[model samples]
Target: MARPLLRLLAASCALGAMAGSAAAQVADHGAPWLENPFPSTYVPLPRSDVMLRHATILDGAGNRIDDGDVLVRSGKIAAVGRALANPGGAREIDARGRWITPGVIDVHSHDGTYVLPLTTIDREAGDVSEGSDVNVADTWIETAVNPQDTAFSRALRNGVTTIQILPGSSPIFSGRAVTVKPIRATSVAAMKFPGAPYGFKMACGENPKENGAETHRGPTSRQGVVTYVRKAFMDAQQILRDQKGEDGKPGPRRGPPAGRGPDLKREALAGIMAGDLRLNMHCYRADDMATMLSVAKEFGFHITAFHHATEAYKMPAALREAGTCAAVWGDWWGYKMEALDAVRANAPMLDRAGVCVTMHSDSPGSGQRLTIEAAKAAGAGRRMGIVVPPERMIRWVTSNSAKVLGLEDRIGTLAPGYNADLVVWSGDPFSVYTKADLVFIDGAIAADRSAPPASPASDFELGRVAAVRP
Candidate 1:
């Protein structure tokens, strides 16, 4: 169920206070901070009083408005045109010769779940698995989310305003995923999009096998993987049926509601079955991808996106027909047998076939710099004679990702009524040397390379730089 807007605002306020308190405590200890040195002081100001003028606006809708002025007020884009009525007391920013676009969104990421500055062993500490079963349908990535991680700042620096933090695909049905803002807040609620549906993390091939060897349970083989997912959905259907009365009255409310469950796995699966949760499946091969689509059809649920779909170009028509999204890498290939057919032209081919394709960087190192990934896709498409436009290519990492995460209306474009989440680039964003000059999330400045924020000390980063200096 979606949280009330008031509740979300209150939660954000509480979490902000908690984050401030945590930072103060860490500083009191007089120790170096192990987390990112950036501060997370996001105080939302009145957006009605800000405007960016004389900029080339690349609206993520595949349109470019040159020498335009964008007026934002109350955190929503109010006007975008050549001439603007500047109300009194509005701050006008000179953006001449610069490019403005929606802040980049990474549809596939693992930053929050497997957070750095903490031991990797903590990922396994919580029983993310249920009953020792691989397909834990009730586990939520948000529940285990640690909001104080340093990767949020790094993501902000790279112009990534939002990301879907997914669990590692160690199981066929890994767990639920969360869509989060790459900002500093003390709790998951503050960072979470208020009503965004949770996502089920399903996987195929290598990651599902136990101990790198086939076991007796389902999904030991490729066929087994398909069967396992089908069976689970069938069970969920049965549960759904039993929970509803023949007279159209609710029956005993099933096991439990979302976000509160004795059986964590089933709780997560229930959300999917009820169409309240999206499915973000990870598959590499074309055949497996087809089978997964078939399973979705049999269960009457839609797949939001397929991550790391290296061979998606082969079945672009099918993917397009089903309205499924392909979140893929630009040129990563041959790391395994399933990924052998990965080609540089994959994204272009899919795009030409009218598939909603988005490029993603699954690596921690690569996640912070996905503009380069989009550039690579554009370069590959151009090399293959695809002639994809620059505006269209930018959509692969911005608007298309927002579509996959079901947040297209809010942050993926610089249009009227959209949230003021945008990035100012130092040069043409497609160029290799281009960088983010400023990043705004919900009309608040989150990152400005020209004037960086004061570094906040945590227990682990105190005086270490000075001590190591020559």
Candidate 2:
């Protein structure tokens, strides 16, 4: 992290008090702090050099190769081609009948944060949405992440290796998003993706406004929601301006008036302005999305993606022009008024208009079956004569989604020098009958069907094992 960014975070920590105990834990940042408070403790599992040969490969960049080979060495892809010379002593896997592709990346998920075993038990119901206020920018979703969430194991079994866990859409500014690798770990930090940038989660449309209305607070209408967002950004802009010196040099003479505590909300919102945090907005209607684009222009910050953008097809050109990705569900629609205009060909239309299109799973079940969800969208495209092939459609769950998280260079594709995060399927990945035979994370076998213990189970699942057996 840069010194300026660190100072910004320290200033944010100076807020008088936070909503919950989680923020209070990391509230005090003494001088000379050089590390993140919630730093990653993830270590790659033991792995060995391996060569998978004669498999059909979709490299996650709109290319397919048959009878191909993938060489994994030191937890990174060493080579990818046909008939490549294998440096001896590498374990060889005969994958002649299998299909290999980049591991599935779910851009929008609430797996760990929402958690399982929905009950009245403390913390078991999960800390999803903090409805106390409209802007909870100071909060982070990872603080409530339960590493023991059984959903991680289920997602691993279905070939998902990386997931960007976001806060729920029940607040205008929900919280910050955390990207994690779905691996067995003791702490949420152990699953955090190293070097991944943080994402700010914001929302528009029915969910936020309705939640506030039900709580008997303000912002019951769409205009009120927009007003809240605009006012927050305006405050953030003031913070940035106040941080600069009159002489245009670094000094305590300008930023925050020397001794006063920093505004945590504006500090976090400033991160988006400083280009340090990616902005992900949950929006559904076309008009609402366009309104967000205009706000982005006014504030000089980019909207990285529009999650659950059901009506993005209606304004594909605007999304493409803004270079914002439309992360949508495959076929989910009609559940609410804003989502009623969704079409099955939403993704295909965006693709046709040269927009970056990706698919997302906002639920646990959909997270496990992400590939088939992409297939559903692609199938809908085919019916509309859009003709998205398997090679390109695979990107909806892989590379394009990676782009949404701003980690496309490392984990999304099967290119040389990329992380060896991939999956081998029993058959065509899009086929409903096919399943992930093996899944690898950073060259380590995370799941294997031919071997015992297909995937590591959470403690919750382990306790239930006896009940499932005779």
Candidate 3:
């Protein structure tokens, strides 16, 4: 391992020399250079003041208030309490016998990138993987996200308001992920969450190695994956180093050495080092996670979260020590060798050990019912003497998931001055029979059970994809 890293360091230094001039042109790490060329044009729907009264409220931060009242004014949560002053001109809904909680957030999803109507014939059927290289950090998943994916509406009806659309894990550094609001829009920028930091997608264990072996490229072994990742970051570090001159001062501004363009690859990687892009990794085993943590330490970056961490329960203390969250499934296990040791009590065990844990849905179907998924994990714990209350269980799908996306302060809690992105359930959120009575995004009704167009549909579902003969 040491010999390979030394050789890689030498090779990356040469590549860095060619890219240094162009890379140094970037003033602020990677944020300014990789600024969304296509910025978000998200415009919240026009909304009126709303006051929900007489409901069981789970504030998404481990607080439960019975018979509470919540006030939404001008797209923000104005107040939340057992009783609130009723302002004039606000629509009051007596939410008797209902429950309220922050809208469900799915930290890991492939809805738009890997569209439905699965077929290889269409060019847009699958845009999840960029197979050209093992480290295509220059690529952005938002570029391939199709706005007409019908899965968005299904998730919305189930109270999923925000999602991070990540790239496939076929490569060590797959690409950058885009977080977006689940809204009907003609373009991805329209649904993009304003001011949300980008996510860098990474993977270890079977997927990358298998893809490399099959494609005859990238890393074909576990150690190879770590080595390739280290090499890429090392090159990024070299580029960042060039920002300072021989006099130990900031380098003079000379935009991109003639004939060279911006190095988007290194810029994205450097973004992670600069705290601009959150790092989300796909690792199943405890050993692989530990190895990745060492790489993060060497590069001086914090991993935001680990997705599909099937064996994360084996090392709760390490995750807590590293401040990395584990985004896992409820009962998924034994399907693959890496996930063979997955136990139902993964989340509860980690929570008991003071590790931040969330229940994530990697599938389109599972994305719609994340609350039930969290309940599944909690129920498993209950069967084994680990008690999880409703107030705390709600965080796994709401605040905890929001923390993984770095949007906890804004979207995940029903607090004053926060975005009024929440759901009103007909009954207890944990019950399978109960449905989201109302779903609000930015204090506007995005989905309503008793209203017209109860479930939103995309243009594709209403036009070309609908029955033509009828």
Candidate 4:
């Protein structure tokens, strides 16, 4: 981690400014870069109070309303119905043929973390894993976040307003993941999602083993990985029992870990045990996910979601019972042994069996068409005489993913109290020719197909790289 970030974390922890009252009790040696500016570069347009009348609306909660009206006031969905009594001063648009849905929430992305110029001839510039020890939970992707990444522009045009930038999963534990609004900002802190809890990344398959083998570490097998995880948490538990409170004395056992951790790794592990940090575990096989669930249960820490779980369909019942969501692709299989047994219906099958299912793009290009990915996954179920409606398929990229990221309360659904993060599609979102005609982030226009929308372009791309589409 960078020295500036460490200084900020130290200052925030010392002043009790990280977040909430619990920050005073939580361990102070991890990623706590919570001092953020307003949503970076996202200018609120004059039409902050606008109403879209007579459109097909997908609430992102499995409800579809034809000829619906959504009124946005003060960056919130004020009303949603067939005929809303519009405010006299609000701007109104007759969206007759368009469809409105909540802005896409990408659960697993490496955009800022693996920023522009991914490859520099010799090595990838933003490889964010400490492979030497395979347990750098103290490290954070935020310090590596390059807000100048041009990928943010493409995603915004595709209706993605929010995304979780996670660390690479090459090691057993990479580090803490940061959530951000996909705005091309001057710095990552300016784009950080307010009030969103921090997440940690953990991988449990071929990548970790390979990294360990290359580094001459001990965790060369799955058993070894499991053993290492157990010991790390147990050690963290002991440390949590040995920290001091903000008043320079041991406080009552309430929320968060007991006190400050001696190191970054211990602080993060303690955060997980305190039950506020979300774990975005990268596992491909069903057996590995099953074992992970058992481990999470033993440690009393929840596994929020399993990323790239290609074989999630094989263990839908277990996943559903464990209350963990699966973030997967349309048909990314056969590339590796663990991911080889996957079928295209993996997502659909998981959906049918009552497991929380979502489609995610670990690749930057694939992320541009995540709606198409969900359409394909739903199409696979259609061939099998099972129907995955567009309304439900939308959740595979919107609500379901948001729930996994712990931002469901604020942004996912197009409800009355949720953030007015929505996209207006020219046609059915699942249709190949459809494009995001107008996108709203917090009720402000972020993109438009008809006009040159606000520039999501980074300062780095302003003069050097011209805008291709807009």
Candidate 5:
């Protein structure tokens, strides 16, 4: 049933319960259901004006603006320069001697959907999978996304302003990925980053193979995995061609008519073929990565980035030649057969080869502390005798990831025209001990450690004390 009709049925049932005492008991039980129910509408809250002065700014464009003053007016960056005066009416923040950069963006994340705070029983309906099929390209992560989850707060406190949440790699073609703003809001639409393009979550190697094997599918081996992907693309190509008409004679339209057919798989492949969606493949083996690149070339689609690319260092030249970005972990190794060859210097080696490398934390626990992940990458590079400048290292999480997300024009850098998404660290960002003093999302202060929120339960100690006294 449609959501509105279901809600109407529920309301009618509640109204009908006042006929008798037993009916009144039913009404009492339904009261909690009426409080903050699903499919709730959201109105975005008003943002505050903010200004920061006297900060060491890493602009995410590999340039440093020493002692810069950044002015944010009406939720956008108004000015960024040296020795600038703040507008008199704006709220001012003193960030002297602190490192300020654009808020970090994680290209690969699974925080909101595969959440831990909610009970696991909520996912028992098997909605996480589609029709018992592994390749569910049409399913969107946004549909499963929960905006008001505590993970959103955790991610924002860790300085992540935006994230591209993807489906798990348990399938060959997992689903569509959605980019979201890390903010507490009433609905997912309120938290969505406007105009951000959707990405397709594609996988190779172990994930698809293992899933297919368990289901008695042919793709139990690496070669079988490649064949499965190739067959799907080939069918999609045929479908596209048939829709275009054979010899201009008007053949039967493939899948469904424009905006009419409900075939999710074909619609997803069509989006890819038309270049409306990006493909983010999860692969760790070097040969599998190469195969994915070749397949993308054959299909005339762009490979936006490779996630968990542990063996990316082995094929740095190939990756750079293909103009693909690598979203990899800092130093995770020996956890899987494909990742056995992973090394600590993987990120730096790819960086030195002129390949775009971004540090990604695929785990929810790790996503809450990505600054330390970036620091680990930098430290590993230094230990490997490869000297990457601190500014360049900052780009791996900020500008470079934004570039991979196709959002470089907006939120990656601290330029005048970019979105005022920034973070102020308590100390040097490269040091592991440093913490985020303040975090801003679209020029509005989202978190501040020193000054807590107006709510008494905003801090741990106050919350415990309040409980004890009661």
Candidate 6:
């Protein structure tokens, strides 16, 4: 009755013996997001052409342009330069002392899905784990998101224009994650970032073991976790083998070949192998990440990003070469054993090594002030003699984050043909006293401090959420 053996026995019992036909279908039409049965219904709010002149623009491309003007027309950036031509009918704003940058993007967030049950404010079912069994990779976090959660509004006020809502990290494969626009809506579909690739959520250490081994459900150890993950992918591979050559038909099942319908769980794994889904693994330790990287290579898959990579500084050379972005925090660490190795200079250290670094707010409270979080990492870099200016630091929450989800070209930059999602700061964004004077998404005034809370204000925060600019 060893823990590992017991875990395998349970998995076999749960996913045991589906007919060959079901496995075939799973591998054939894999990656639901490509065909997207539930497509996004998001349309940018109505906006007029706008011209913001005399602003310091942190272009989100590691360049700073002072006293520049940005023009927005038709929900897209028309041009960016010093004294760009203002459209004839655009509303002009005198941003003489303000700083403008591409909107902040939080790559790792659980706001709408894991809504906090605040006594003052306001939080999924069954999405993180299925039947208390790990490896529920097929489930969708979007279906479980509560649009009414007040965190979205708070995140908006904090200048977060976009955030990816992730499932809890309790399972080794904690289902799928969806990127969302921080706008008020009745359904998660309305908030979905249109055409963004879905993210496959996987965890390596700590959370999964505590959930499975402690609960006697599955995977009691790190080795056991890897074993479980490998077997799942192998099962998907078997499906692929059977379905090959005879496209659209059922492949021969190993034992007796008799099952109906596609196995969503296996399809998700196949999506990863096929490179249709981006893998965002929640791994804190470097050794575990290395192991996961090996597993991915073995199965011919790629990791898009590593969440909470506190120990990534140790393996920067490999991570940089692999092109894996390390989504980290500012200074929140050392409260646990795995996090004891965390250093304030982790982000800069990794950046200096040519690795992609992004600052993430894993908590609802932290999601609001993400710029401040990135500033903390930048300050730590300065202390280490690694020169990081506001322009470069802005990428930790903007362009680099967009790159994590493969949405860099559209959002995350204030360039022509990109989404006109930019924020105007009352002062230097790195300072604690600065506030987002205006937040624009797709050229529309999403949050404007010039007036009282307007369109972006949710029903939940109509009276309480106010503009905070001088």
Task: Give each model's whole-structure lDDT.
Answer: 0.72, 0.84, 0.86, 0.80, 0.74, 0.80
**Cα distance off (Å), candidate 2, residue 14:** 25
Q: Kindly give the number of clashing pairs for every candidate.
A: 15, 0, 0, 0, 0, 3
TM-score of each predicted structure versus truth: 0.83, 0.90, 0.90, 0.87, 0.83, 0.87
Tens digits of per-residue lDDT for model 2 on 62-123? 99999999999999999998997889978999999899999999999998777677775325
Query: Which candidate has the highest lDDT of all?
Result: 3
lDDT tens digits by residue: candidate 6, 1-470: 12232233223322322433323433343223234556799989989999999999999998899999999999999999997776599999999999999999999988776655543332132232343568888788888888977888778876889999888788888888899999888998999998787887999998888888677888989999999999998887654443333543322333213674667788678667766678999999899899999888787777999999999999998898788899999988888778889888889888888899998998888898888888887788889899887888888899999999889999999899999999999999888999888999988888776676555545555445677998
RMSD per prediction, one decimal?
Answer: 9.6, 6.0, 5.9, 6.6, 12.0, 8.2
Candidate 2 stretches with Cα past 4 Å from truth are 1-35, 120-124, 249-255, 454-456, 463-470
* Candidate 2, run of 10 with poorest lDDT: 26-35
Instruction: For model 3, name the residue pairs that clash.
Output: none
- Which tens-of-lDDT digit does each residue in 1-470 have in candidate 4? 12232233345454554454543434343332232322333444445699999999998999999999999999999999899997787899999999999999888898865666656621466655656578988787778877778788789889898888888888798888888887657787778887687888999988888777877875899888999999998877654444334653333333334474346677678667655578999999988999989888777777999999998988888898889999999978898899889889888899999999988989787788889999888889889977988888899989998898888998879999898999999989988899998888888887777886455555656655667996
- Give the CA lDDT, 0 to 100, for residue 359 in model 3: 89
In candidate 4, where is summed lDDT lowest over 10 consecutive residues? Answer: 29-38
Residue 361 lDDT, candidate 6, scale 0-100: 91
lDDT of 3 by residue, 39-134 (tens): 899999879999999999999989999999999999999999988988888899999899999999999999897788777732548988899998
Q: Give the lowest summed-lDDT range of ten residues in model 5.
A: 31-40
**Candidate 3: segments with Cα more than 4 A from true spot:** 1-34, 121-124, 245-260, 454-459, 462-470
Q: Find the 10 residues in a row with the least total lDDT in model 3.
A: 1-10
Q: Candidate 5's residue-wise lDDT over 1-470, tens digit each?
A: 12232243334434444554333423433221121112223333467777888898887888878788888887788888888876678888789979888898888887667665445533742133332466788677778776645667778887888888888887888878878887776567778787676688888998778878887644788887788887887776543444334453223324354675455686577556545567899999899999989888777667889999999989988898888999998878898799899888788888888999998878777787776787787788899799887778889899999988889899888887788888998777777777888888877777877876534332222323445553
Off by over 4 Å in 1: 1-48, 117-131, 210-218, 248-263, 457-470
458: Cα error in model 5, Å:
12
Candidate 5 Cα outliers beyond 4 Å, as residue runs: 1-44, 117-131, 242-261, 453-470
